[model samples]
Each structure stands twice: as C-alpha cells, then as structure tokens.
Target: MAAEKKTAIPKDIVALSFEQALAELEAIVARLEGGQVDLEESIGIYERGALLKAHCEAKLQAAQTKVDRIVVGADGGLKTESAEIG
Candidate 1:
C-alpha cells in the first residue's frame, strides 16, 4: 500500500486567511508564467504555491460543509441535515 503524501505546511501559511493565501498563490503563478524567476526560485515558489492551493481548497471545503448542513425547515425553522443538498 502506498502511504499518503502530505506536504509540511509552514507555520506562516497555517496562520494565513484564505484570501491571503490565494493572493500569494496568484503572485507565484504570475512569476512562473512571466519566466522572470530563475530555476531555483521558481521551484521554491511552485512548492509554496502548491501549499497555498491546498490550503485554499481546505478552507473552501469547510465552508461548503457548513453551508450544506443548514436548511430552512417547512415550519420556517433552521435545521441541519446530512442528506444530499440539491
């Protein structure tokens, strides 16, 4: 069996809000696409960008889970359900 691969997230990255992480990721992409960074720097930023992307995905998934759980009942009361959300 293959062990799951997990990147070690930097402490600073863990503290960043979703927006901050995304902005940094965008900048990394721009640098890579512009071909301004040297090979070493490009590799470094690409790794960071991967971490940022994963962080953003985790944040969005948490938000989606919360949103999916809440529903307004027929009686106009708010409740949570595990059922599939349309």
Candidate 2:
C-alpha cells in the first residue's frame, strides 16, 4: 500500500508569514521559468503561487492601512494621499 498524500488546508496559508509565502512564490516562478517541470506539476505550482501571491498582497495591504492611519503633521489631521503609488 502506498502512503496517501495530505491535502493542503486553507489554514496552512494563514499560518505562513509574508516572507515565507513570498519565498515559495519565487521558487515556483523559478521552477516554471526553468521549463523542466511537467504540465501537471507546473499547474499545481501555479495554483499554489497564486494563493501565496494573494496572501502576500493581503498582508501588505493590512500593513499599509496601519501605516496610513498615522498622520504626521503639526495639526494632527488625517493624512490624505493617493492610495496607489508607484
């Protein structure tokens, strides 16, 4: 009998830090770019990469919101600026 592979749960992603998720995403990109992985493996990696990307984005957005809440001015007013910055 062969050992069964465990399916990844949503909580697994929640547990991963932004850095760890980004690292995994980079590895996935490198593997796909190398053109060595088969179609099925590539698809699986792509899916995982997408999830990691979303998780990273969410973390970044949350951090940005936290930073934006702090206004740096003598008057102590809410800072209003372009949310999308290059």
Candidate 3:
C-alpha cells in the first residue's frame, strides 16, 4: 500500500479547488514534519506538496485578476481600477 501510494500520481491535482488543494497540502506538511516517514516517502510527499502549492498560487492569481479596486475619481465619483495582488 505504501509503495502504491508512492507510485500514484494525482492527475486531478491541478483540477482541485483552492480549498481542497490547500487542505491536502497542509496535511502533507504536517505529515512530513512529523518525522515518521523515511527519506523516500518524504521526497514523494514533498513533490506532491510542490504541486499543491503551485495549484493554490494559480488559483489566487486567477482570483486576483477578477478583483477590482475602487478609487475616487477627479469628478468626485467612484471608479474602478484593476488591482494587482502579488
């Protein structure tokens, strides 16, 4: 079972929702930090964590693109500007 888990690839990792990916990533971090796994398993989980981190970052970037900032215009009216959140 452990060998199968190491060999399995999360093909849907990229398709996972932001919350789902984040939760899985957090779990991986906790498991890795627990110091119970050997080096090989640690490397496998670390790779998965990297993918999860990328997915979360992409989700955040996509959400940021849709975010708009409200600013006061010269005519004393509210205007919207594309806000970039890094």
The numbered model that scores best in TM-score is 1
- Clash counts for the predictions, in order: 0, 0, 0
Cα distance off (Å), candidate 3, residue 35: 0.6
For residues 3-64, write the lDDT of model 3, one tens digit per residue: 44444445799678899999999999999999998999999899888878777877787753
Task: For model 1, give the 10-residue run with minimal summed lDDT.
Answer: 1-10
Q: Better model by lDDT, 2 or 3?
A: 3
Question: How well is each residue in 5-86 modelled by candidate 1, as lDDT tens digits?
Answer: 2876778988999999999999999999999899999998988888888878788877644444778999999987777657
For model 3, what is the alpha-carbon lDDT of residue 44? 89
Q: Clashes in model 2: which pairs?
A: none
List residue ranges in candidate 1 displaced over 4 A.
1-5, 64-86
RMSD of 1: 6.1
Q: Per-prediction TM-score, please?
A: 0.67, 0.63, 0.61
What are the candidates' C-alpha RMSDs?
A: 6.1, 9.4, 8.9
* Model with the higher lDDT, candidate 1 or 2: 1
Q: What does candidate 2 score on TM?
A: 0.63
lDDT of 2 by residue, 1-86 (tens): 01111334367877999999999899999999999999999998878777777778778987534223345678876675544443
